[model samples]
Target: MTVRRPIQRFYTEPAPMNKLGKPHLQVVRSISVGQAPNIPDTDGVNEMLAKAGPSATLKDVARGILDRLVERPELEVQVEEILFLKDCLGASLEWLCSLAASDGAACFKRPLLWSGWCSRCDCEAKDYLMIYTKQVNANSCPGTPGSRSRTPSVAFSRPPSWESLDANILEDFDKWDFDSFQLSEATKGSPLHFAGWKALGGFLGEEPSDVFLEMERTSRFLEAVEDMYARQDTVLYHNNVHAADVTQCVHALLLQFGFAAYFDQLSILALLLGAIVHDMGHDGRTNSYHANVCDDIALTYNDISVLENMHISKTFKLMHSDPSTNILEGFKLEHRNRLRKEMVEVVLGTDMSSHFGNVADFKTLIEKLGSDPAEWHHEPKAMSALRVMVLHAMDISNPAKVLPLSDKWSDLLRQEFFLQGDEEKRLGLPISPLCDRETVRFASSQVGFFTIIVQPTFTLMAELQHRVKDVLLTHLQTNTEAWEARKRKEQLGLEISQALPLLKIRPLESTELTDLAVFPDTGACLFSPSRGGSTRDVPCDSQSHGQPRVPAVQRNVEDVEGSDDETALAALAALACCASVEAQVAKGFHKNRPAAPAEAFALFY
Candidate 1:
C-alpha cells in the first residue's frame, strides 16, 4: 500500500472526530495537480481550527501514536492515524505560520495553544513532523539559489547523539539552550537525575571521601526530587523537565560566567541544589491558586511565598528522610546551616511576586560592583544575594533561550497559565495576566514581556558577565526583536516572512548536514553544518548577524538503523539538555545530500 505523506491540509469535508473528540482534522488531497497551496491564502485554516479543534488534544494523540511506534516499530500494523495526525499538526502549524505568511484581517484567539502544541510536539524524541521553527523571525533560510552547494570550512555531524544523550550532552555542558524535554523523554520522564548529576557533579566530586559514594548519594537526592516532580499530580510546565532546564541553565551560567572564581564550592552546591529542588512539590497551580483557594500549603506559610517555602521545606525534609539522600550529611552544623540558608534565599527568589524586586536589587548590586570593582573583587561578601538573584534569572530565563527553545518554554508556560485561567473562570476568580485563552494576544504579550522584563534583566547580566554579553545577551536581543516583529506584522496583517530577509545559519559553519532538522516553514534547523565534526564549540546561529556560507555534507554509507532498548533509553535520558537546532536546516540548504537515514525518520513503505 502506498501511503502519501500529507504535508499540506486539503479541504472539501470536515474531518471525522476520533474517540477523543478532536477531529482527524484534514482530508489528504489525492495526488492531483497542485491540490493545495503550500500556505493557504484564505481563512479556511482558521475555520478548520475552530471546528477541527484544539491542537493540544491533537498533540497528545500524536505523541501517543509516536510513543507506541517507538515501542514497537517492528509490528506489522500500519497505523494510518500517524500520517493523519501529522497532516493535522502540519495544518495547525500552517494556521500559525499563515498568521505570519499572509496579510489577513482575522486575528486568532486561544493563542495559548500554538506554543503548547509546537513545544510539546517538537519535544517528541521521535517527532513525525520536520518543521524547523526559524521562519517567524530568523529570516536566514536560503531563498537564493546554489546556497546549499557551498564548501565546508570544518567538519560537523548531528547534535550530541541521542543514543547516550545524558552522558553525551555533558560534553556540551556550557550551552545555554538546553532541551530538557528531549532529556525528559530520554530519562523516561525523569530528567533531574541526569541534569542534577551534571550540575552538581563538580561539587560532589571535589575532594570527595569516596567519589562513587558521593555520586550515589547525589543520585538518591536527585531521584527523590525527580519523583516529587513526577508525582501522581501532573504539572504540565513546572515539572521535572522544567526543573532540569533551570538546573542545567544555572550550571551553564555558573560555568560561562565563571562564578566559581568567586563563590565557594559550597555556595555552588547550594545554588545547584536550589535549582534542582526549587519547585519540588509544585502542584501545577501557581502560589496565587494556593492562596486564593486557602489550600493547606497556603495556610501553612501564611500565604507569603507559599509555594517557595513549601519547595524549600519539602526538599530539606526529603533530604533528611534517608542518609543516602542527605548530600550535606558529612558537613559540619555551621556549614550545613549556611548552605540551607543560602538555598532558602535562592528558591525564595523564584517567587513571582518577588520578580521585579529581585531584578531591582540585582540592578543596584550591579551598580555597586561597577562603582567599586576593587572592593568587591576580593570580598565577594554578598554571595547569598548574588546566588538568589542568579536563580531568579535562571528560573525566568525561558525568554533568554534561542527561538526553538524559547517558544517551547512559552508554550509550556502558557498551557499552565491557561489551565489556571480555566480554573479561575470555573471558580469566579480574575484570570491572571497572560493566562486567559480567549482574550490574550500571546505574540503581543511576549513582546511586552521581552521589552519590560527579559531585556533589562539580561542587560544587567550582560553588564555583569562578559560571556553573557558576547553569547547570551545577543540571543536575548535577537529573540526580543523576533517577538517584536511578530507582534508588528500580526498587527499590520503583513506577511511576516516577507518583512524579514533570507539569511544563513552561522552556527552550521562547523558541522555537517547530518545535523539537519527539517522545518515545515522557514529554515528550521538552527543552522546547516560546516564540515563533518567540531560543532561542540560552535555557538547557535543567532550569535552572528552575518550569514555563513552553506556547505554540502555527503555520506557514502553509514549505519543509521538507530539504537533501541537499553542503549537508546540511556542516551535519550541525557537528551534533556541538548538537541542541536542546527540539524533542522536540511531543506533550507544542502538539499543535495543523500536521503536521510531511517533513524533520522526518513520513512519508506
Candidate 2:
C-alpha cells in the first residue's frame, strides 16, 4: 500500500483537535471549547437535545435551539439541524404527542420552528471542519459573507393563521339569533325589554325611539309569553323564541329585499308583531282541543283555523291586560285595526293543519309579480302574499340548515318535545307521530317528514324566489341521507363490531323531527314507516318497529261505539216495512182498497 498519508482531516484556524488522540466519550465540555460541534447533524440534533437535558422533549429542545439560532445572528446551526428542528416542532409531532398523551398538552402549546434549509453544503461543512455553518453566500462563505446583498427594502412579513381565519365564517352570527337573547336586569331599559326583544329590534323600522320606548313599557308582557311556552305537561311546542325567529326572518326579508311598496312601515310592523304574538294560547292540544276544551278561543273567531285564531286572540288579550303593554299606543283607531288584521293574517298562516288557501293565493300574487316586474312594487296583493309566505317559510326553515347547525337545533327541539311527550303520557293523552317518546331513531322519521312537508314547501318557494336553492338543496339532501342512514342502521340491529364502516349513523333526537316539522303535539302521527307509509291508526309492534318504538298514549276522549244506536234504529225500520209488504201479499187485496177502507185506516193508524 502506498502509505495513504493518514487521511488528514481539515480544521478551521481557530479550532483545536485533542492533542491526546480524542476526548473521552463521556466528558462534559463547555460549548465555547469547540466550534459548536460542527453545527450538529440531523442525528446530532437529537443527540444535542439528549445532551442538553432530560426534561426537554424532542420538540421543545429542537424548536428552542433553532429559534435561538434564528433570532441571534451570532448563533449558527447546520441545515440538517434546522430541518430536524422543523420535524420535531411540526403540527404532526404535536398531533402524535396529543394522541399518545392522556391529556392533550402538545396541541394546546404549539411551538414554532424553522421549516426551510439547504442540505448539501451543510453535510460538506460539518465533515470538513468541526464547526457549525450558518446560511451560506453564493460563494459558500458562512453567514452574510460572499452572498447576494440584502436590499434596503427587504423585510420579513408575518403570515396569517389561515385555518383560524377560515373557521370564523361558521361562528359569526350563530349565537346572535332570537333563540339566544333573553331579558336580564341589565337589558331592562333597552330596546329589548320583552322576551326576545333584541331580536325584534328590526321590526321597529324607521321608528327607533318609538321602538325603544315600546320595548321599555312592554317588558312585563314577557311573563305571559313565558307562561304560555313553559307549561307543565303536553308539548306546547311552538314558543316565544320560535315566534321571534319568524319575526326576525320577516324583518330580514323586508329590509334586505324590500317587498311590495304597499306593505309600508305599517304593513311591516303588523307582519312582524303578529308573527311574534300568533301562537300565544296553544294548549298543547290538537283539533279536538280547539273544538272542545279551549273552545272559547275557537268560538271567538268561529271554526275557521280554530287554534291559530285562538292564539292570535290570546296575543291581543295579553296586550290589553295592561295599558303599558299595549303596542298601539300612538296609532289612530283605524290604523290600529288595520295593523291588527295584518298581524292576524300572518299569525294564522302558521297552523300546520290549517287550510293553506292563503298560501296558494299568495303564490298566485307572486306569479303575477313575475309576469309584471313594474307592477310588483307597492301592490297590495304582492305585499300581503309576500308577508304570509315569508312567515310560513321561516316557521318551517329549521330543516333547511347545514347539518352541524341543523343537527344542533334538531337536538334542542327534540329534547323539548320528548319532555312534552312525557307530559302527554302522564295526562292520558295520545302521543303524536314525531312526539312518540319511544322513538329510537328520529333521523329516519325526519327524512320522511322532510320528503312530505318541508322540502316540497321550500322547493316551491325556491322555484318562485330563485334564490337560496343551492343552499336549500344541499341541506335537503344532506339531512335526508343522514336520517335515512340512521334509520337503516337501526333497522339492521347491528352493534359497533358488526357495524359496517359505511353504515355509521347518528343517533336521533327530538329536535331533529321538530326541525323537519312542528312536532305534532298529539300522539296521532299521520306518517309511520311501519304502516307502509300509511296514516292508518294501528297497533305498534315493538319487535318489527326496530329498537326504539313509539309508545302509545291512552286517549282521554270518547270513542265511536260501532253500530249500536244507529244500527238498532235502522233494523226496526226495515222490519216494519217487510211486515207490511208481506201482509199485502198474503191477503191478495191489492186492488180491493175501496171495500176495505176501514181496515186500511186501522193499519195506517
Best by lDDT: 1
What is the alpha-carbon lDDT for the whole of candidate 1?
Answer: 0.55
Model 1 segments more than 4 A misplaced? 1-163, 166-168, 205-213, 231-233, 371-381, 489-605
lDDT of 1 by residue, 1-605 (tens): 99997544333334454334545444333323211112211233334344434332333434444565567767432223322232333223333342221111112222121111233343342122221111122132222211112111111111233335554454454567767777777766667877876565434321122111144566667888888884323667888888998998887787656554445556667788899999987877888878889989999999999999999999888877777687776677787888898899899988979878877876777676672222454545455557777788888888878888998888777888899999999999878777788777787888888878877777776776677777777777888888886675354222213212222323333334344333222232222233432212333344555432232223311221232222222222112112332444333332343343322111100
* Each prediction's TM-score versus the true structure: 0.53, 0.45
Give me the displacement of residue 602 in model 2, in angstroms: 84
Q: Write the per-residue lDDT of candidate 2 for residues 193-263, one digit (tens) a residue.
A: 23233233322211112222243333445445555653323432455445544555554444333332335
Best by TM-score: 1
Query: Which lDDT values do the candidates have, in the order given?
Result: 0.55, 0.43
Model 2, residue 62: distance off in Å is: 55
Residue 496 local lDDT, model 1: 17
